[model samples]
Target chain A: MNRRAFLATTAAGAAVAAFPAILKAQGGDTIKVGFPGPTTGPFGALAKDQQQGASVAMEEINAKGGILGRRLEILFRDDQLKPAVGAQRTKELIENERCEFIVGGLAAHVQMAINEQTKKAGKLFISVSQSDEITARPDWGPLTFHEALNPTITSRAVGNWLAQNLGKKWWILYADYAWGKQNNAVLTEVLKRQGGVLLGSTPYPLGNPEFSAHLPKILAAKPEVLVTMTPGADNIAFLKQAISFGMKKEMKIAQPLHWLPQLKEGGPDLYADIYAGINFSWQLEDAIPEAKNYVALYRKKHNEPPGDYSAYAYSAIHEVARGITLAKVVNSDAVASALIANPVYNHYKGKQWWRACDHKAFQDLWIVKGRERSKMKGEWDFVDIVQKVAASEELDRSCKEKGFV
Target chain B: MAELTLATLAAQAFTGLVLGMILVLLAIGLSLIFGLMTVVNFAHGSLYMLGAYLGFFLIGYTKSFWLALVVAPLLVGALGFGIERFLVRPLYGRSIDDPLLLTFGLSLVMVETVRLIWGKIGLTLDPPRELAGAVNLGFTYFPLYRLFVIGVTVVVLVALFVFLEKTNVGLIIRAGSRDPLMVKALGFDLGRVWLLVFGIGTALAGLAGILAGPMRGVYAEMGVTIIIESFVVVVVGGMGSLVGAIVAGIAIGEVVSLTTLFAPKFAEIMVFIVMALVLLVRPSGLFGESGLME
Candidate 1:
């Protein structure tokens, strides 16, 4: 062989020999967490808030010498609010990006798809979206942890409050989807248990813009309260139209969740007199030290108050990091065991514990009434916290109902 | 269920009519562009969303919904003119798929642009103070803005009808759409006419957007849902026929509205069902002329 050819072959052999070490060094530098969210569609704002919250958690973790003596990193992928897209992105995150843990699913149905992929890969999936089914039957696994409040908890809290305050006759209007249906069923059950009269129920398509058509039926029923479960833009449209039709004069309006970003968009005037259940309110800073810290940190970064959904992502990231720290390893099984064993966390609010039976986080839920414009103290102060529903195992379905018994 | 009284029926009917008018406003723009240019402008919805955004900003600046109403459509029309001139005109002679794909991509780009400019957060636009409240119609209290929308739609429809029927420019546009080469040979600037028609079509979409902004808050993906429905309206109405668009738009609207009362689960699909039934009966649509499919 020629001299030059001999040198080239030697160089190629050395490069191949060094490649695995290089890959190991690169991989070991930081722990990657996969976050697939609906960052582009209707849920874009919420997804952005989640990303910001995750960033803050990442920063804090890295500053304290990240999990297992390695820096922590988050990889965000846009799911475009589609379940198929979410699943695909999650697969890419696990298989290609080599993310050992998964976080994020802004929409209810989309989160289930993400969970399925994470389950197949045997990676811990900390879902940040709400859905009763996420923790119940067929979907939950050893590695599945839900940080957001499920519909059952939200509905029961708000339902008990509405029953005691608002009159018995209630009409329901919900976006025809999994999340909406779940809230409707749970709320209906709670209300019926309290001897509430069911006026009627209307299920409109998701993302529906027109609610005027349903006004006649609602008017005819003359319900004392109108409970709507339309999420996001649909909720705003429904309320605006409902108010315009003078339905507010006849019946009070309430919902399972009051999204902070939405409250900002819809304004105080539109949301005034409406009641909703929420996970966190910025005003909690007055009483909760963690909330104050979180709101301050988030405001410093984003120049806005942290949304309720933001707390979910923030807590999920922190808890996952804590699990890694406790396990003293990057392995999924070790982290899962650590989290499941410990089972208690308080990232940005009151104490929340993970139910060993279902892996659902039991946290305090609040019922808030929208404050009128005259009573508002600031732009973000849209709702007044009226009642707190203490977190408990009873707020969730029994283990048997979860098919765990 | 409550008794379906005459009062209830009247309320439901008015609701249906309002929805129909909004659909009419949107679908007319889609119909006009297709009728005149045979360009399936998928970007029409983006243009509508643009109008809403522009109106939102204009209202912030000018503090006048009325001024935004007049100006936003014109701004959108100007944009349509540019889109037709620079982007669409070059693809005119290619496979019809060329323009369809281009416009589809344009829609995606436009949505992203809006997001970049306005951020992903949704924003609301309030109706003018005068039209903010409900009006008692005895049957039910209806939104004054909605009633205003109906009135504006009727006036706009009447004006459009007169323009299309009686004007020389409208005649030239009609002739050029049928036989572009013949019209070009007859010494008329067919390119300008096509551009104008595209502009007018998109401006109608813009008008619909601003009108809808108050009812439905302005957001990045606001157009994505309505665009599909507008296409359904156009197809069910007959691809390029104005009268067909009007009739199908209203019929589909009423179907959706009434279905909410009787069978809420089917409200979304009722439009598609109507479209299928119409196609099964008259493939060309209610008022469509023959041979466009060829």
Candidate 2:
């Protein structure tokens, strides 16, 4: 080929590479949403599910001709579950990608870091992780919207339910972290209200492999019910060690968000008869038609049932799309106003409405019990929901009393 | 406190035996490498993880757990051979810090590679049907697979001991550990012995991984946590002392198991505290030679 033709081809390729940037620079036509979370660490599975949920929502929205006729684009960056990385990635998303809104924060610390930036930038930030009432507090920022149920609400509901149904005496084993401390406080309040007494409480450092050291103290307490908030692989290790220590035979075990698929790694029989509180479950049929559809799609795509984090991300994206439509503009302030003012938005869990007091969305919580596969019909049918906790009852009074609004 | 009395102590002692078996498999390789070559194989845990994944894949493909159990270690040993010859040999005679740094970096690469291939979620490997359930120990129910691990490690340790004591290659290895210069002066190829020692050490790590695959779910980061505890075992037992490794492995295991009876939260810290006290008393380790400081 001649130099002229070659030069033309090279120039054409360069333009193709820079097309998206040029379009973005000319006018913010595309609505960009940033997903910053741990995509390659211990919590990578949770982060990946959240990202997938958001991706699915964006895909569905774009298929129907996106919000305000502009396609919604989601940019994912792995925060590695660190606050510093989350902050750095948030800044990059805002400055470089020029995202109009931000969504997805798997870790509590990451959410706090991103919240700091979003508050200053006046951008709408949707959190899909647990971080107690800190994120929901008005002092944190009006721009932040917690899509997931806060730990305070979750703990209170769990404690109250156990006290009323299971037993009045409780033994607590909590990770020594900010979320754990807040959860303990909330549980203590709820337990007191339900005429329950805290027998004993042991705090363990997060990711400690050996739980044998704390097992004796817990067993010695001899409470009717034992409650713990250690999540991830540590949960499996703790539960199995508890069984080895004969804690399972003595006292009933309760966990907040322990019925996840990660527990299956420990073994099918590890959490047998144990009760767990969860925000969402694929098994709940009457709750949302979208959940059933999500289960089917996720199974077809990944050959497995969609977990809570996946559903949360998927629903949060749809919610964000609704806000974008309401705003009708790709501006941060406009989107924030749309999210705040909007009420009774349709999510996978039927219709969810954000409580104005705490800026937390209200949804149904399920109490599930672990059962053996032989006792069940299918492979993923390990959990049987015992009760459905209504959204109104667990509205988190602390936020209301403190006037977070 | 009464719950953790003599009866509970006996129960935890059994639990410790199971845990120690796995640790011994891990520590033997670590001890052998340090003993013969004075090289700390930081990537030992990665090799163990690799063995588990290899065993999982092998079993899936071959439909034979026995084949996987045998083949995984060989594959790991081959890889160790390549690593020692190509990557590790050049760093010989250098500061001990170099191998530590190099192996640490190698571990990162191995972990990332595993993640890239298998993803971050852990995969389970079930034990053979004959050893799948728990065995009734009268006082406490023990997992059959864990018991199998203890049995396998005992057989392996005995075989290793006999080989080292009775075989010709074992004698050369022991002599080389004492003085490589003297062994080289005797017209024996110390280079080949070093290669074999490193390969066998890594192979033992792989064996531990395969045995543990059925217990601890095989994941990329499986090595990170296990490696730290293994180091503590090595330190407590005396670096490079095979007998020390065995005693320290079981001792640490018992400490962890029994501590959970009284103070479950401090069980992890208690193991390290014990190591610190051991170090204060004997800096070279419980079994390490005082004159052989690297």
Candidate 3:
């Protein structure tokens, strides 16, 4: 065929392929939400947990005669934990899948890329990843909402607890990345304010396989507390190597966040005695009625307790459904306004609210320690909640600081 | 700055030595495959990862690390033998890229299969009880398991050296790598030699994997990260040279470990920098037989 005929036939084929999807969207019986996650790579398990949580939420929502009388559907895409891939996935969700809203990002940097795409597409994005930049200054928009706790809150909560309880001498072992550096800085500030001495700080490249060389320096410094900011696979590798070197016996280990899935996988031997800040834990079911119900519901479908990221995704989907329910419309601005007007909602844990200033969710952050192997009640019972930092405006960046004043 | 005393330096060097040994195990396999067939075995890391997984399951079933160590490599070697026979044999006379690309695809399939079977979370394995804790050296406390890894590697390398340098089969294999046509002319089965060499190469990877499990946890994507570093070791050591693999692996390991002590941020980059500098000095690598153009 000639060039003109070839181009015309290809366009015709594309239009014919898109016709069925257009027909499907016109049915209006289901509401579509794009959920992009790092479904492959080191963080794959964590992302799988988030997808599992989304599955439970979808089931419950659809069971309740659906959101606004329409069945709720989540379209899952793998972002591969890459910023560019995340942007492309978000674009596909909006333009191709016709998802009205987007949710889920496991990595902090990748979430920003998703947010940028959502902003351009004028879609409501409920981010499940924790990044200070996602809700502050240049990136925050009317439709950008963050459900996960940022590094600031996590660092302050865990740092204060460690400084007051663990010891005065501190050493920070952090991954060299935007999120890791931000956590290190916040924790340092928190420690300094508590009259703690900074012994030393070591920043290793992300995905670094070994930590033994750095341990000698840490041991030599003899810091009372060793705070690590390694995430996902890096975290597992670091802790395993450090434990082999007997670093745990010498100093208290701590981190901004403890991934429950990792704790379950590593078991008590590797994770036990390491204190960390967390967004939510199933152990909260003891105190909160909603948490109990949520855990029970999740346990029926999955063998293990819902992870911290699972909680974020569960809350994001539920809150968005609630917003759509309140507004009785699928429009982004209307639902966003409805969500802002009604800030407080209880889905899994105690009360959590989306702050009106920057659409950043303010929720209780807990400090937890891994349970000893012998003390464990069940397979999933890996942590014991030590303290709960109540949700408060004081814990979040000020509205003025977020450039919203 | 944290004070780096003599003790600290000694401990860091030991750490480097341990890491280098692991690289040596991984790179030797890669070098052997390339030396024989001129096909870069991109799936070498996958074999290593599979070995770790097999070791994990074997230990769970048999409750013995020693048995798993022996059986896991054998299992991976068998798999490597099948891959060479079925997947790589047909592409023997084609462009080197044919088998290279095939192995790369094989790596992806193997990783996905692992994820399907084992799930995505990392699984930890403690070293044998005898090698669990740290040893109080004069300088600093070092993990006994790491010391054991170095010792085991030394013994394995020594045995490998003797076999390759002394035995008739080893001589035949070496001659085959140098000139397969001449080895065939002598009535030797070149195909079987190639298959055996590939199996041996992959078995080394499996052995390294099991050894690495206790130090770095086993997961599906564990192979992805280590593959690049192993490639660096193979290239810097001279693509097909066994001695080059050993020397370059240990040197790169020491560079990474020591750099972490003095300049933590430059540790990962230093490995590549060393490779670049070596290539600039010798385009065909340290012990390569032919120039790049040839």
Candidate 4:
């Protein structure tokens, strides 16, 4: 007890004291950023794609010169699309790892939960997932930034475009969930404003394999457009059945969101006559040289063209880096204030601005049509841009107008 | 609400029947194994997932959807035989809990293995070109592939019924499920019967998987989507009753289909409600019997 026990007690104390020194040695004066996303669920593909985007940005930023003369480091964790896991990881990254800034959110509820955690900790959080509710609320925090396009804004943009081109009658086949319901409500409001009639709507369960029963009901409506609010497997199921039943030839499909993972899974046949409105596209590389440059860099690293989520995730990280460089400090307060004050910037697009009122970014909305298999140039190529609507004018009322302080 | 014509009702019924057939295949697969071995198959859905993934890769290599559809299920069946012989056979004389634990853990292993092999992203399986378009029935334009699903289910069901009722092996299985002790006393190897039944049941699940691949995007968690629904089908139909599964599958399918015409929001929930109501009335299930699978 007096000899061996005393020596063992001293060893335990030394290891505890050495832990922080070990972390410092490994990190090496780097600005550690945390990334949390669904890495193994149904939505894992998009999560990996988005994470790749952020990773590439980190590598590039460090290659030249990182923020405050230090290399940028990223700590990645998988949330598995669970809100509780996301919130827990956010706190760990902020409290334990001393992450100065964190980005990446996949599911809407996960982002909402993490927003609360990040706000309380006063750490900067950028969400790459679609969740309008996350950016706008009475208690909107200065530290929270939303990178992905809002659900309502994108849906409205698609609706307005659909009304002009595909007649004024619409039918909806959507999944019955919070995200799907949000899409449906926004699309309904937009179509009403545009003087289009809601012919009928059907909401199926999440991950439902069969859509044959509902397809006949949708077709019977004789609507000019079939708007689907489901994504991933359900999206593929609905479209495949729709095409099989000859619904594609009868009416145009208005998909409110464009996820590259699902597109690749469904093949380009899905995009044959489908319509959607999204903020970023790898195809946008054709219009903007910077976009092409980013795509080339991402492809070189990932061996695949970055999807919309990937491109957004990449841009969001660089946005934080640029903010840190401008602030000349690694503190969260400095980065947040610098970003809010100077919102206009050019990266993947010509010029996009992050609105101060809601922290929502305004950029060009690319309206796209499904590129035919014959017309597609490469494997990743899927959609053809129909129009590029200015985000400011085309988007619906901002969060500020919607009564968020 | 729009007017519902006779034509519309017929089309909905036809569509519901197609859904019912897929459910039937899955339900029967679950019911047969339970009947033969008295071992609840938690990994059956995982087996089904393997079938789809195998079919997807086979198509890629062979460039023949037809060959993949035919071969994947047989390969899965052979795998099922091995799983029962090595993993499941050892636990037969032990507590029933042992097999259940093995299967539940085995399912996790299988799901993760597929995730690693295929990655987390979904893989597409294009339907045969001949079945891609619509078939005009004058009443309504129906998807040809969906029609094909219904056709395959009927042929499979008929083959299954003939095997279970007409053949000597089917008689032995029926007798064995009825009384394992009695069949063993009669000089039959109950061990061999259990293996065959487990293999055949899983192969049926594999067939359903291959059939569903074109419709449902082939992904790692595709098994998860159908496992619960099949369990519900098994429970609602009766624990080990083949006919009960067929009837319950169609009943649940039509309930969901017809509900879509009125309240699509409650379609999934409604199936559960119906199951709850049925259980309240029939404590043992529609055709469940005391010591049925003993």
Candidate 5:
């Protein structure tokens, strides 16, 4: 063949190969959000709720003609609640699926994994998981944003509230894990600041069926209040066994995630009068009309009141959508810049904003007590909000001092 | 700590008995399988989980608890029989460790299969209407379903004891456990006896799972935790001794319950501690016979 013909053929093939990329860069009609969370594991229930909430929010956004008239499409991948899986999935979502933004993190470890990966990729990562001080700290990556309440903030708030309302003496029984340990440390510091004495503290292995060994030590200490950071079946089992052992009669129980419905599944009698800190509750109608509307809409659609994870996931999707609108572009860098620059958007909880220093979003935390079944109107009814603690009052400045932001 | 009160102690004791009863049901199948086959079926816990999921699905479909109670075990037993006939039968003359390793691998495969089929969300099965609520025992309120479990376990143990002691097939099986060569020499089909023993053993594990489904959430990894404790029970009970399994199972259960009353954190580790102590005191186990297999 002639040299001219050969050159022309080669040029045509190269142009065909690069055409798709050029079209993609010009801006597609669809805005894709990547979600990686524990869809199957011990926290699988929470993952399911998160998926539902995100889907609902996406539907709402699409119904309103989506962001900048582009349909919002969420491509969710299961991280399996492992840090390694989280990192791998984040890489795949960004490099392969070409997702414009990323959302959802069920566990703190997974969140940290995604944070590192998204930072490297220079993409926005809005975390739904609780890891106390990632967002408001200057040391944190610029691309990260958090929608959930910080563990340190929530724990300190609960501890201070307990010291003031319940008693001065406190005992801590936490799961022997990173989140549990950190939460206990923060609570201890906050309680001491509030003029409360830390009588004793014990860490139990995750998924240990019997808490009998720790119960005796706790009973011996006989502190006025007991704070537990247990979640899932572990929390349910602890509460049931605690009631049977008569620990409830001696000391008031405070769980950070106690308002979760899993506690009620152990039986209403066991969880009765137990205090827990939550970001939002279906019973918080008097606090925020949007929360009330959220509960009604959630129930109307799912036949149940929205849990913490669900509400967070729903709010995250809406927040991301708003950011996309503000940026007027689906590119990751543009949307991220808009999210960082914008003030707190009114979420389901209330007016909330991401702290630029650490990227943590500060919001109201509610203290709820489990009520007796006789007082409850239905199966899902268990907790009643006792107090609505404001974000500004509850947030600790130590996060800044500790260089968490 | 303050002086322990009698009322509290009594309540703990009652709780212990209830806990022990569940352990007894879980350990019986493992004990029986070990005795007859000289094979420590590590997949026993997987069988239990299968039973629970099967019962959950069956009960949901039929809306008849009785039907599920009967059918779930039978299905699990059949699966166990298949495993024994195809996988286990070939490795019979190999080192004892071979079966243990084989069963462990089988357990992982079974657990993963269940996860793929059912998803990882833990499922809760409701107790039947008659046994749903708690009963106040004057001093304390006890879950009625738990009490029912104790009663059912007692009945099963009694029936199992009678069958092992009185029935012809049970006698043949027991004799085979002592000398499989002698049984084969006598012109009896030893393979059939082995299969039956394996089937029955796996079915008992399934029965335990079905009973426990309502008490605890059924999930893919549900068997992982229970199997470890069950192994401790088997070792403490003296390997393959049925009576020893019962006694040790109940003892371990009580220890767990009472320990929770005093120290909730150490309750889990206490089982292993007791096993270590039992091994130190009686190397062959409480009822285990020395040099019985080798």
Candidate 6:
């Protein structure tokens, strides 16, 4: 027993004693919200924007003395839009970081993987993006709630308007994957039932760089309207090439979804005359003061207005805080019930509730037209809100038909 | 007024040809690097992407696409020279595996570096106003920018041919690629040839990238996707054979274009299917001699 041995023994004992306290400090006593998304891939900007939105929510919530007397905190980890990375990061969020709930989602496959992990972990989950199958059967769980429109809801929201004005003869160009396939199917059902002709519904392979081969076939179909279901960068490429080919002047162009960043990236000249259905917009002028306040607060703090993902996070924090207040407990079951209770939780997204059957937040979607360069008032004023469709009127019963009573 | 008239096929044929021209430009660059160094430069695509970004910067600062078209390639070529000297020269004469592994890692590093600088969102350039509209080709309306793509390809290919067939430098490169040891034994400066070949190869890819910037909507991952198809074109045309590469590029482009008319989902995979079948029969490629890969 030398002096060196004694010193080594003391250091080992102290490390063992401090480990639990370190772990506890790492978890903290605050309410932790985890957000895992594509913070490094193509959609990285959107994820970073969502992180800012989540921060804004935490700021507003903590200013009011936090949620249930505990300070609210947000933890962001880049999922890189990889499904495996998403699952692993989320497991760390719950198991290690002690995140009580999860928010923010993008890319269907990534979100779908996170759904399985969240359900297994029994952590409350809310998706702020439009994931087609997150609430679908075999994948849908009691704890997961979708805050945006699904494929069916989006299809229904813009269905009638597209058929009536853009002509019933439709040609669809979509990425060949679950989300894209679901888009093709849902749009088909809605359009065909209204006596609309299905000219060509082409599933372009995912990550296909060139549309030279596909665009001509779309034209050969002679469709009165070309509905593009490819989201993000792919959507930009298709529209630009289509515009250069004079497709916009030949026939109307539309997408199931489009975002502010994309409109900016694609340029208004290329995006002109393109119609789309969306769950949220930054330019809500009339409705709730909180919604308006959130926009103003975000603009003041970040110097840019928030998009739908930002608004979703802002409202989600408010909803969670209310759930905690009513349930009087932080347990998953209590908050879950409180969130889906009788009167339904009404927040910034209008009268909305998590449909217990499908775990989807039933809400509204708007049809919008891309503004021409000449008609634009400002840089961001790129779209004209055409119509708003309520969820109550166009609820997709398919989720109920999938063995969910 | 019918959708499936003869006019449709004629339009598709032209579309495929334009797309093939883009492939020809991209694949020729890759083939030259492989032939000159025998180092499969996976970072070729990243260089192409750099061309697009460099073009965007030049266009933004100077407000001229013409300047970008001329300058982007030269800048990328200079960068390629630096890379070959420092990063690649050390790996030369090593096991083929070393350069392959290094270039693969370099591609990811370059892409991530670009992501850090540009952010992961995409950037797009608009075609000049003069090339914005479509020109009626009697049968159908054809985009003027796409036509410009074909015109640029022809000029590039002819220039490349003249450089190869009508110059002492071209003859030396062809001889060096065939028998480098022999060329070195004959007292030729093979090192300078290596530098020139790498620079010119990457410059061609950069030119293609800038041209595609308006069409593809430049992004970090944009290079990764197009590079795979370029590799496919390289293999199909006969590795190291420029004529083979160009012919295969056009052929595959037409096949991809026409196949979509019948089976849209199959059009993408059809390129690979043809590649696989071609390899089964002619492992050396359509225009490749058996020893050309060496």
Give the TM-scores of the predictions, in the order they appear.
0.88, 0.87, 0.89, 0.92, 0.81, 0.92
User: Cα deviation in Å at residue A377, candidate 6?
Assistant: 2.8
Report the C-alpha lDDT of model 1 over B153-182, residue by residue, as the tens digit: 899889988888899998887787678889
lDDT for residue A278 in candidate 5, whole number 0-100: 85
Per-residue C-alpha lDDT of model 5 across residues B136-185, encoded as one tens digit per residue = 66655566777788888899899988898999888888898888889899
DockQ of 4: 0.59
TM-score of 3: 0.89
Query: Candidate 2 chain A — worst ten consecutive residues by lDDT sum?
Result: A208-217
Give me candidate 1's TM-score against the actual structure.
0.88
Q: What is the Å distance of residue B41 in model 3 from its true position?
A: 2.5
Chain B: TM-scores of all predictions: 0.98, 0.97, 0.98, 0.96, 0.96, 0.97
Q: Each model's DockQ?
A: 0.60, 0.24, 0.55, 0.59, 0.22, 0.57
CAPRI level of candidate 5: incorrect
Q: Which 10-residue window of candidate 2 chain B scores lowest in summed lDDT? A: B1-10
Each model's number of backbone clashes? 0, 10, 0, 1, 30, 0
The Cα local distance difference test for each model comes to: 0.89, 0.80, 0.90, 0.85, 0.80, 0.82
Decide which is better by DockQ, 3 or 6. 6
lDDT of 6 by residue, B1-294 (tens): 236878889988998998788788889988998877888888888989999999998999999999889999999999989888889999887888888788889889989998889877888888877788889888878889999989989998999999999999999999998899999999999989999988998898899899999988888887887788889999998888889899999998898888877788788789999999989999988888797544
Across residues A1-405, which tens digit of lDDT does each residue of candidate 3 receive? 999999999999999999989978765678999999999877887899899999889999999899878999999999999999999999999998889999999878899899999999899999997889889889888899999999888898788889999998999999998889999999989989999999988899887767887988788888999999998788888988998888989999999988887887778988899899988888888899988887888889997678888988998999889999999998788889999999889899888988888988989988999788999998888888999888887776788987887
Which number leads on lDDT?
Answer: 3
Tens digit per residue, CA lDDT, model 2, A214-277: 5545655678999987877667767766765567777899987754557556555776788878
Candidate 2 vs candidate 5, DockQ winner: 2
Model 4 TM-score, all chains together: 0.92
TM-score of chain A of each: 0.93, 0.91, 0.92, 0.92, 0.89, 0.90
